[model samples]
Target: MVDQLRPNPAYIEAVLADAALSPYRTWMGLGITELECDRALVVLDIEDHHLQLRGTVAGGVMASLIDTATFWSAFVRAPADAGVANVDLRVNYLEAVPKGARRLIAEGRCLRPGRRLSYAEAYVRDERGHVVAHGMSSVLTLAGKGLAIDLPKYLEENE
Candidate 1:
């Protein structure tokens, strides 16, 4: 089944482009280096704003990275019009990211994919290749509501 889930090149390209253009992804400096049937690789260059007073990467940033990577891992198998919503997310902070680390890499893989739900896991590693955090997520797949879809004009106007 996994073998049959391979994403086409165009779909992969679209996913990467959307990730690059998303406002939140842009703000977080997230970049998608690879996207496959059930796996994804993402990177974030460390910045001052991403750190805490203790000089370590903030937990929220790590969480967001995990979530995004996990979502994409499952999304590669979803219908073009499908959207993903978080059902649950669990993260284990294994070690603090060092202050001097220049970048963080997140590798995510889908454990299972289904019509209504998907499960995925992600590991965040520092530039030194030490795992700083690990995460697992379950997502609800919503058909006919893709992440890349434009919102209604009325909704945008109201906002």
Candidate 2:
């Protein structure tokens, strides 16, 4: 099993900031206000863009939620690097989210964190109290300085 590391305060702050600025257009501007790994809880707030054609939460949105949540699960169990890269991700959508499913919340946990990879699972539930989607994924660390400390204000504080 790969040894998990603790995230410095700055790194955590930056990740939350990244969640706000996530480049994925679907989740762009979205924010996950609360998160913890020991208990494996992931909470996120949905914005207008997450809605689908009928105003129901889009399937893609749910997928993103699962992916993001599982990422955090793995992140908390892996080396503290803000720049971990996804080696692969696969999802299975189980149900449609009703319009205004209320608030989106994802619950996920780390399955394993090996020397070279990390695996995690997450389920997306609509505010309606229905399972919207489920997913699992793996991440691969790449060549980079990686995040080790409170990210310098230069990184998180900036774009």
Clashes of 1: 0
Instruction: Show where candidate 1 strays beyond 4 Å.
Output: 1-4, 147-159
Error (Å) of candidate 2 at residue 98 is: 1.3
For candidate 1, the C-alpha RMSD (Å) to the true structure equals: 6.5
CA error at residue 97 for candidate 1, angstroms: 0.6
Q: TM-score for all predictions?
A: 0.87, 0.70
lDDT of 2 by residue, 90-124 (tens): 88888776655557678877777655677888887
Candidate lDDT scores, in order, read 0.82, 0.62
Best by lDDT: 1
lDDT of 1 by residue, 74-143 (tens): 8878776677876889999999998788999999899998889989999999999999999999978888
